[model samples]
Target: MSVKETAQEVLKKIGGSKNVESVTHCVTRLRFVLRDFSLPNKEEVASIDGVISVIEQGGQYQVVIGNKVSEVYDEVLKELDGSDPTDKIESKAHHKSLFDKFTAMISGIFMPVMGAMAGSGMIKGVLAILTITNLLSEESGTYIILYGLSNAFFYFMPVILGASAAKYFKMDIFVGAVLGAALIYPTFIPFASEGELSFLGISVNMMDYTSTVFPVIVAVWFASKVNMIAEKFMPKDLKFLLVPAIVLLISVPVTLIVIGPIITLLSNVLADAVNAIYNFSPALAGAVIGGPWILMVMFGLHWAFIPIFIANMASQGYDPMMGLLLANQFAMAGATIAVGIKTKNDKLKALSLSTGVTTLFGISEPALYGVLLPNKKPLIAAIIGGSFGGVIAGIANTVQYSFGGSGLLGIPLIINTSGIDNGFYGGIASQIVGFIVGFALTYTWGFKEKSTVDSDDYSGNNTLLNTKINVNDILSGEVVALSEVPDKVFSEGLMGQGLAVIPNDGKVYAPFDGVVTMIFPTKHAIGLTSSDGIELLIHVGVDTVELNGVGFKSFVASDQKISKGDLLLEIDLAVLKQSNFQIITPILITNPDKFSKVSHENNNLILAN
Candidate 1:
């Protein structure tokens, strides 16, 4: 089906475009704020073509469509006559819970700038390595410049955060930037001294805002509120002139006098809490912290520790909590590598290997999402491995001297400048233990191989060998780009690129002589390998995996020979449409690289050629 047709159907199933207050999309879901939740039929919406699932969370009805959500959202906007919810209406109408609102706001504000922050941190890590090795002089101009480059992002964090927060808060970007700038202004910071500072007889408290998180965020939220009020009351002609002026005038002083001091006190309270936990029992604290680092990081709950971590670093020149996280990332890397080595599936192996390398460097999301989470046992093994490593770290009382993002580089970062120490050497030993324990445990007991032959194996991608091979048209129907497939695994060409078809006939014909190596229980997906070793995976309908065997009838079974034009499967199109399932079947050349070049005829064929 055409994208337009699919979009129209989706809109209709969700109570039409008129019922939608606004629509947005993330990586894999279409988020909708409806005028009335009672108006839309959720089960029917979930059954819609191209939809993976339906979720109602955080005051939004979400339609999961995998990687192609952006495309569908664009189509949705067009169908809605380009009407979108205004900023004020969106902020007011979402009705999200406090926790949800706070997390969403923080994630939205930090996501864009986080890449540069992490990258620059890695650069600093490398410089630390060079200096430690005596390969680069710490006093060199090159070192100074590169170090400055690394520090600049964090030093002016408020500016970057303000711009992003302003967009989320529906305030002027320039005003937000100015708000960030005023916090870090050199002259104003010195005047923060108690009894030494006054602004027109109002006492000013000495509060440091540099490299802080809550103050600027709270200030921006206040500024947004002030801006909205200013807009409502100010003259229309003077809105542009007076709105920002009024907002800044109210927000800055309020932040300085009230918000900043309160947040600083809160930061101290949070720090004291963490310190108390560590002092209770470092080993138990380390184990508890290390086991769930990934979960904390995923939900952004780890931000709560930022003030503590930064404060510890400033006061004592190191943070012990940093010691706990290093083990966790390395353990994740180890688990992923074990999966890569133990699995027979090629795609999973490749994914695990790549993600494992990043995990080793303290970038664990790839490993977390791609390998560990999907495979339950590996997650358990990695966490246990991390706990062991954390216990080792706690016993040694490990501390990191420098803050750099890489877990692999943490070894060097922890090294004391004057000389070597037990903490640095013990951290290395702990990471090694983490890697070994994670890999060994997962490889031994965690991974479960799929019980299937060539066709159903989830791992392999390319199976081409050295020789000339026959290339024949796979399916005879209306051809569509593989990228048009709503599922990211196929649409991104990650599963091997091939066109799809809207079957002209209800029956699926075999494209080449092959053995039906695998036939799924649902009969929605079939896998075959030709005598020449060309694997083909024919999946009928978008997200039909959810439908089980309904409306699908298989004529062939596993280990059966399939000749060209032989009837393989039959589908009841009428039943499919009534069930709200798509009829766009993807005929993928699962191992396209096996042939020098592969192309489909995409021709109208009454019978197989």
Candidate 2:
């Protein structure tokens, strides 16, 4: 499906735009805050074509969309243009714990800026490479310009974060930016270093706000609350002018006097605590963090660490946490490759190999969800491998000088500002240990290929049926070839073959006398196993699962015995058609391998008999 289609499908399944309280995208996922959390079906969202997985954690509904998340995010934004107005309903977030709300706010503010941050970090990494090689002197004009390019984002972080945080807090974006600018206004910067200062006869706590995280976010939040009060009291005619004026007037001074110093201190404490843990025992810290890194990513808990990472970079100019994460990526890749090599299923082999390569490039969601996690053992092996890599990196005191790099490509990020050192070598060694150990362990005993017979390879099943199973049409409709069905799973015969029908009526009769094996909660599909052992699937419409059972009606319960002509389901054909869902129903022989001569006869005319 096209990215736009994926976005639309996702939007529909998540209760359309009305249910979304807010939405944002991080590196590889679309995070949503919803008004009604129960509206979305996790299974349906995950099954969307471009979606990798669905996670509900930290009070956010996250749909993993791999690397193209930004594109999908843009499309989602376009579709959400008419989203329900704020104040119309209370967000589900209000009931979440303080920590959940805080994480959501952090992710909302930081996610938009991460790309630029990563890009700037990469520029710094590249500059390091050039300077170390002696190809570019630090004193050169070119170096000066490149250095500025690398430093601009971090140096002016407050302004960028102000704009993003404004969106989250529902304040004027430029006003939020101006509030940030007030902290580092060029004329006011000198007083911070000069020590004692007073504003409006109140002693102002002077602190440099450059490259900071928490202060600006807190400031914007404060401004949003103040703006809300100003709106309520200020006269409508003068509200626009005075509200912002009053907001900036009150917010700027309050932040300089109160929020800035407090948050900065807390941020430092957090960063220091992290460093202390690593310092106490690098190997143990590495093992502890590395062991569950993939699981953290899966649950969307990793976003909580972004602030600490930025704080480390701001205070120490280097961060060790990223190295542990990179190790996990290599471990995931290694385990995935092993699965590819060991899996006997051709489809699984292709998926494993492709997702393995993606993991090597720093996108591990596909590998973790599609391959390793499903197999269980490979996931354990990957975690074990990552722990070892983390230990090695910890012992070497490896740190990332900048961000943006992951997997093997991120090796340059470990180069210390002084020059190439033991840390860089440690990073390389860690990845090697991670990949090799993950591969070796998984290859040795982590995986066992499950045997299955491919339909194309069937030899002994040619004449196995002792009696002919005559199938009848379950619905009155125009017969359509299964190969022409819109869904690939049916069109390609991947789910076995039968035929499709464009229904002119709603009722579905049993195709053969058998027990109903399954009935999807959405009621868009049903499964049956014939008395003679023929398994059949009757799916009402292509992509109709997104309808959430709105127009589908089940007439028979699962495990119920039925005759060939018994009523089974009732689809509201007009309702489905009105909603733009294709009403072409597919009747499939799910176990076509058991038949030798599966053919449609009598001009493909199927009738209940």
Candidate 3:
């Protein structure tokens, strides 16, 4: 199918052009904030041709379309809006939940730094192994260089975290980073040494700031809130300077005296609790963590565990959690690989295969986003496999001696001659076994049967059995017949024979067996010529022509034969709103003079087939 066809199908399945509120794109996904999530037939949308997956998280409905998402997003916008992009905001406050907010915060703050953190962690783990094996000396210059590079991320974590937190809070990220840096300055170090110290006559005695987590986050959050208030009250001319001054003055002291101590205490308590649990029953701890590892990945909160692993490695030179996590990685990888092999769609197969490889290399974002999350069965299989593997690793008392990288290859770092002897081979064997079991199970019994044939059945031509079309078969909304439409071109019968459909959603689809004749390069309008010579022009969303082709994507282009009910477009209505375009879509026929009469049968739920 061509891009145009895909775009139309997406729009229709999601409940037509009017249902859309706004649209946007990030990397490989189209992020949409719908005015009404209820309208889109999610199951049908997922089953549409050219779509990879649909994910609903953090109050956003994301469509994963792989590397071509940008191109598709552009086409979708053109279909909704003609030349200008929309700029409208949908109120997400109503949909906000504690879990949703927390996940959003974590994802926004941690995603960007993940690569750097992983790279540094891996390097540090390698250094630990070298030192443990007596292959490097503590004072060696080469070791120091590598160690410094690896240590940089941790030593300056507050800065990175602060920037990410600022972004989450929609505040000035640079200022937040500077404030975080201030917490670790030499001036604060003295407060750690002396019995008592004061900052500007305020008593400053609490937890040490170095290697701290909660202080910067709390401070930045406060700063963001203060900045917002200041921006509103202060005069436009002085707002920038005033906001920063007020935010810093209010936030720094609050952080030093209250936020830092409270969060530090909480962290310590949590750490102590985890340590106690581990001490009591390592196997139980492993089992508990392993069982829910997939959940952590889904919510994107796994980053929180990084500091714990680092602390354990620094204090005791080994951690059991890391070993168990390795099992989790392989389970996901194996499941993804199995799915890749089973898939017949070339695009899905390639994505699954690539993601599987990346999972093996300890980067599972592609797999998590593109494959596992959409296919529920594979994810469940992986979780079960991971848990079983964790049980084995725990029973054997396998522990990792370093804090970097994860998955099968990281096994070497876990083997310490001086530590508990589980033999390197034992850890390796458990991980391999878990991976194989997960792959085999998912391939054989975990998944639903995928479609082997093309979606052409839904895209072929069919003669309308009768001329009396039911408007209710289309969908719910204010109904207006073709003659009632205000546009002269539409009322004068210049377009076509079909009724003028004012969709509640910004979606459109093939009305009958036809061949797409012209898909406006901007993606705003599509022309379909039925096999019976009835021509149709589906101009999606009123005034969406102004979106300048931003969030629209098409599946089929000009001259492609289509059947009734075929998907033609997928639009990001959120983007349309963001670009200040209307969501109401107008379906018109460019060759209206040829038809005897155009009429509406009912006002809701239009059925083309």
Q: Highest TM-score: which candidate?
A: 2
* Local distance difference test scores for all models: 0.71, 0.81, 0.67
Superior candidate under TM-score, 1 versus 3: 1
Q: Which portions of model 1 show Cα errors greater than 4 Å?
A: 1-96, 193-195, 314-317, 401-404, 409-420, 453-609
Name model 2 segments beyond 4 Å from true: 82-94, 453-609
Ranking by lDDT: 2, 1, 3
Candidate 1 has a TM-score of 0.62
Give one digit per residue, the lDDT tens place, for model 3 in 1-609.
766777778877776566565566654566665666655644456556667667677655667665566677878888778523354434334367876765555555655676687677677667767887789887899998998998787777778888877876778888888778877776677767666666788787655566555668778988898888889899999976778778888887788777877877776776677677767776676667774787875654565675566556544656767676667778888988998898775766887889887777666656865677656678788887787777777777777765556675576566773532673555676678668877988898875433221122222233632333343333334556555554323432333333455556555567678899999877878888878776566766544554677788888899999988777887776786666454444465444334433333444212222
Q: What is the clash count of model 3?
A: 104
Cα deviation at 12, candidate 1, in Å, is: 13
Q: For residues 186-304, what per-residue lDDT tens digits would candidate 1 score against the true structure?
A: 88777765345566678768576776677788889889999999999999999998898888898888887888788878877877788888878877877888767766765557655
What would the TM-score be for candidate 2 when compared with the true structure? 0.74
Best by lDDT: 2
TM per candidate comes to 0.62, 0.74, 0.61
lDDT of 2 by residue, 1-609 (tens): 999999999999998888888888776789898888867766568778999778777888989898789899999999988665653654453367877777778877887788898889888988888889899999999999999999999989999999999988999999999998888888777878787578889998788888888999999999999999999999999987899999999999999999998999998888889888888998888898875887876765777788898888887898888766558888889999998998776887898899899889887887887778766789999999999999999888888878785886687688776789988888888888899889999999788653221323323342543433333367887876776676545664546667788888899888678999999999999999978787888899887887899988888899999888888888899898787677888887766545544555432321111
Candidate 2 overall lDDT versus native: 0.81
